[model samples]
Target: MNLATNVRIVLVEPAGALNVGAIARVMKNMGLYQLVLVNPQCDPLGEEARRMAVHGGEVLEGATRFENLPEALEGCQRAIATTARDRHVPLTLETPKQVLPWCLEGSPTALIFGPEYRGLSNQELNYAQRFLGIPSNPEYPSLNLAQAVAVCVYELYQLSQNNLAVPPQTTEAARLEDIEGYYQHLESTLLKIGYLQPHTATARMAKFRRLYNRASLSHDEVALLRGILRQVEWAIKPQAGDAE
Candidate 1:
């Protein structure tokens, strides 16, 4: 569970010094150090943040500031945005428990937190490939910014510590290339059978892609799907007599 260096915590327009400091302390406790601030409203080095940071002062001082969320996440390949409220934006929301595996998959990842008062805007959330929703009492579902980070980071830490043996990295998950090919085959097959209209094809395909992507289908699964598409295509095409 050597995740100490793989994750960057990004705070967007944090207004409370105490929360920033507290988050630094938690980050230190969890053995994580990379912190990025986007348009912070308070001096991250102010007394309140430092006081809470205490032994984690180094993490706070070394934190980088950014003008916006995208700048902070420039080189990051994977990002998970935390939100308590539901939005109509098309995103695959997963619980922290479900997202931990992907976060621990040895890639440079970022965990984004939005403004203290409003949380992440819909536009800001779009930068993330996935959304994480922490399970809290529905009666009072809101979580403090620092607290949300603590929960997500801790779950990640625990998953790392468990160290379950994963399949070999050589057996990579299905790539976007293969996924796209499969999508093309599927849509063409569906259209041939009059299941998808030309006018609605794009929107329907987008939703299907999201569903397939969330499963994180492996190479074998993708192959199996492609085979199914081939069979359907062969069966549906007009034969010589049928066409006449």
Candidate 2:
């Protein structure tokens, strides 16, 4: 039903040309097109990549490159990133079947995969509102980059092509930048009010990010929160002299 057009697959710091090429091929097979590479270590158009891409050469050649994850995700309203390992902090890692449908609910959505050696770092993972991990044999749990792409794309393509009931987006989801702005404003306002100490702010803010992400706040909700932060700043500025 032409649903795959809005989906984007992002590869972070991919270093293997073959993996890049194969990923392109699989994406095309699954009727998915958009591909973004963040600080890739290999040329996606190289011979090895092209050889692997074969029929999907167009996808590989058309892939966009970015210096960082946030840059790669600029316009995405919904995103799910993959991580192989567990985190020290609390996070729900869903199976592909469980999270793939979320990709269809928003315009310009994203599914991110980390490099071959290591999956996404905690900082990089924070950018994504959701996280996924494919269930595999625990004794040899890791999957190669191309394989991971293939698996997720296949499942997503099926969900997209079939008229499966993905819950209609009731409210326009806030863009990534909008959510990020709220986080920044929230942090600064909290610090100004002595509610967030500098030493513990990063960790505390992460928990907040996770909380709000799960809420999947709409654009208006984000605006309302930001307005609260602004008013708080205005109310507290007069008491600035008391802090010292």
> Model 2 reaches what TM-score against the true structure?
0.94
Residue-level lDDT tens digits of model 1 in 50-160: 999999999999999989876788666567788878766677678988876877776567899998899999767655667899888999999999999999878877877
The worst-scoring run of ten residues by lDDT in candidate 1 lies at 164-173
Which pairs of residues collide in candidate 2?
A: none
In model 2, the Cα lDDT at residue 212 comes to 97
Model 1: residue 29 alpha-carbon error in angstroms: 0.3
RMSD of each: 7.2, 2.1
Query: Which residue pairs clash within candidate 1?
Result: none
TM-score of each: 0.70, 0.94
For candidate 1, report its TM-score: 0.70
For model 2, how big is the CA root-mean-square deviation? 2.1
- Model 1 C-alpha RMSD vs. true structure (Å) is 7.2
Candidate 2 Cα errors over 4 Å, as ranges: 239-244
